[model samples]
Target: MTAKPLIGITTYLTRARWGAWDLKAALLPASYPAQVQRAGGLAVMLPPDEPGAAEAVVSRLDGLVLGGGEDLDPALYGQAPHARAGAPVPERDRWETALLSAALERGVPVLGICRGMQVMNVQAGGTLCQHVPDLVGHDGHNPAPGTFTDHAVEPVPGTLTGKLLPDAFGVATHHHQSVDRLGEGLVASAYAEDGTVEALERPGGGFVLGVQWHPEAREDLRLTEALVRAAVEGPF
Candidate 1:
C-alpha cells in the first residue's frame, strides 16, 4: 500500500483537566487529527520544543499545521500588550516561530489557522491589530469566550483560498486579533464583510496558506484536504 503523507500539527502545552487529573499537557482538539486522517494523511502532534529543534522536525514531515491557541506576545512584532489580549505562551511562540522558519526553508506545505494565522504574520515581520473588535467595531469575530461564531469570507478570485473555496463561505471564527500590516511576501486572499483579513498566502511559497478561521472545528474538510493533497503531490 502507498504510504500516507505525514502531517505534523502544532499543539497547546496547557494545564488540562481530564478524569480528576489536572496537569500540564500537550493537547490539540480531537478534530485536528480526525480531519487529517479524513484527508488521507498521517497526523502527528508536535508540542513546543527547544529553540532549534524545529529544523529536525520539519525535515521529516511532509506538511505542517500551525494549529490555533493563545494570543502571541505583542513584543514579537514590536508592540505593547493590549488589555484585551490574552497572556502569551512564550515557549510556544518561540518554538512555533522557529518551526515556521525551518518549514519555509525546507519548502514544506503549511496550513495555519486562527492564532496560527497571527503567528505566520508576526513571523514574517508583520503586525496584528491586537483587539480586532477595536478596529471592526464589533465582537462578531470573537463572539464569546471559548465559543465560535459564524461569518462569511470572500476569497480573492485567483488565490489559493479562492480556488478552494471559490465563493463567500461561512467559517467558524473565534479570534480577537487580526492581521494589520501585510506580511513580507504575503498577500490577503480573503476578507470578512467587515474588511477584516480572513486569509493570507505567499504566492511564490509552496502551499503556505493561513486562514483566520477554524476549518477543523466543523465537518468541512476542504481546507484540510487541500493541505494533505499538497503534501502528497510534493512541492509545486
Candidate 2:
C-alpha cells in the first residue's frame, strides 16, 4: 500500500467541558480530521507550542491546515484592535505564524480556513477589515456566536480555487472580519456578493490556498482533497 500523506492541523488551546472534566485542552472540531481522512490523508492535531518549534513540526508533515479560532493580535499587522474583534490568543498567534512561515519556506501544501486565512494574510503583510459588518452593513458573515451563517461565494475563473469550486457555491461562514489589503504575492480568487474577499491564493504555484468559509462543516471535500493530492504528489 502507498504511504498516506501526513497532514498537520493547527488546533485551539482553550478551556472546555467534557464528561465532568472542565479544564484547558488542545481542541479542534472533529470535522477537520474527518474531512482530512475522507480525502485519503492522515490527520494529526497540532496544538500551539513554543515559538521556533514550528520548524521541527513542519519538517515532518506533507501538508498543513491552519484551522479557525480567535482573532489575531492586531499588533501582528501593525494595527490596534478593533472594538469588535475578539480577544487575541498570543500563544496560538506566535506558534501558527511560525508554522506558516516554516511551511511556506519548505513548500508544504497549506490550507487556511476562517481565522487561518487571516493569519496567512497578516503573516504575508496584509491587513484585515476588522469588523466586516461595518463595511458590508450586515452581520450575515457572522450571524451568531458558535453558529455558521450561510452565504454564496463566487470563485474567480482561472484560479486554483475557481478551478476546484468553479460555480458560485454556498458555504458556512462565521467571521466578523475579512481581508482588506491583500498580502504581497497573494491574489483574491473569490468573493461574496458584498465584495468581501472569500478566498486567496499564492499565484504561480505550491498549493498555498486560503478560504474564509469552513469546508469541514460541509460534506464537500474537494478543497481538502486538493491538499491531499498535492501532498501525495510531493513538492512542485
- For model 1, how big is the CA root-mean-square deviation? 0.9
Q: Model 1 off-target regions past 4 Å?
A: none
C-alpha TM-scores of all predictions: 0.98, 0.98
TM-score of 1: 0.98
Evaluated at residue 123, the lDDT of candidate 1 is 94
Residue 29 error for model 1, in Å?
0.8
Cα RMSD, each candidate = 0.9, 1.0
**Highest-lDDT candidate:** 2
How accurate locally is residue 1 in candidate 1, as Cα lDDT from 0 to 100?
Answer: 78
lDDT of each: 0.93, 0.94
Report clash pairs, candidate 1.
none
